[model samples]
Target: MFVRNILSAIIISVAPVSSVLAAGGDTPPIPSQDWSFSGPFGTYDKAALQRGYKIYREVCASCHSMKRVRFRNLEALGYNEDQIKAIAAEYSVEDGPNEDGDMFERAALPSDAFISPFPNDNAAKAANGGAFPPDLSLMTKARANGSNYVHALMTGYKDKLPHGVELSDGQYWNTYFTGNKIAMAPPLMDESISYEDGTIETLDQYAKDISHFLTWAADPYMEERKRTGFKVILFLLIFAGVMYGVKRRIWSNIH
Candidate 1:
């Protein structure tokens, strides 16, 4: 009985992976892109983050929410207090009741979290044909190889369907999404957004920018963490060298 129970647990775990492999057999591997913030010493590209924020605000914000991010967090992307306030004011958020005891809506403040496009999940799903757009705050952290996954997903749409494949009404075909089917339609196109700094406005560039931005959003403290780690390692090495020298001198005198 115990052996059977172990077998059942193993089967349950392996079943999902096997099913995924079967469903995604035709899907190409997600390609890794060179990111400015990839290595232990790597830091975020501030320009990319700003561009990414622009994309998020203008494009993805219509469907997805960055609930974990606050407007003041734009400081990391080099936005000044005034710019952040202006950006925040463009959106409205639900605020506390007045003396009348009624909830009210007001201009968003820098301290407020990013407002959802929909008031709730059901409303979001209703708007998107029964598909709930996910909050993107922790998206890069939630998925395996999330940055690459997001980039691939954003650029993987196909207008032509493979043989024997058909999409349901709201579904679209993507080469990188699991089962080659995704609820969200292709959300980007060439020249969809114009960059004042003259960055290329291609789909691939848009994907890369948004992926970089989401990665930063998921781990804003990555550079600080890396710096602290380097400092700790350097201190440990110096302490170890000092201790070794002290041991050698003490042993030399004893001998």
Candidate 2:
């Protein structure tokens, strides 16, 4: 009887502990698709992309990697070849095997791919404490309504701890990261990277361009594809309308 009573007490104690543990762990609510930042179907904003590139270069590039994208590819975004080459030359890429049979790194060429920040997967994980910052290449498709999600995640970290919760130093909670928590320390700070061209401080514009860039990254052909589709759809509707009128004219004779 004493043992049964002890077990019941233990269960009671553990239950509340578990409940308390669960309560504070809840993530901040994510905005719905109806929200302003939810859609990816938008035109690329040049000024915002320029600002985002500045952010990427000054802030996020230190730890994260975008090895898939070549500096030259930025030319598609309207950068000149000389500008692209100059940018590519800024980074030293991993390379090796000289006549002496030793591995040596060389400056990245315009034609070469961007270098991964970490040497390899193990190194990346070890450095980041087992959380590798995700590549931005396909991040648009990787997350739901990815553009706004990126923006929200950037601006979402809070100074005030939510009830029953604690945030670790240098760790942040993002409303959009899967599981609502992330190892990446909040990367953006207002005026953290200044724009010479005086853009608004609001997150909406920043989020919009980054998402647009990622959308283009996911499918470079998207604009052409969408344009072609619209043309085809319009043509088909016109054809259908013409056929319906012809049918109506034939039916009038019968009537």
Candidate maximizing TM-score: 1
Predicted structure 1: clash tally: 0
Question: TM-scores, in order shown?
Answer: 0.89, 0.76
lDDT by residue (149-236, candidate 2, tens digit) is 6666776777666565566655676655555567887777655566688777555555555556665666556656667877999999
How displaced is residue 62 in candidate 1, in Å? Answer: 0.7
Model 1 over residues 1-255: C-alpha lDDT tens digits? Answer: 999999999999999888866665467779999998988899999989988998998999999989999999999999999999999999887777889998998999999999888888999999999988999999999988999999999999999977667788999999988778889989889999888888999999999999999999999999999999999999999999999999998899774
lDDT of 2: 0.69
Q: Tell me the TM-score of model 1.
A: 0.89
Candidate 2, residue 132: how far the Cα is off, in Å? 1.5
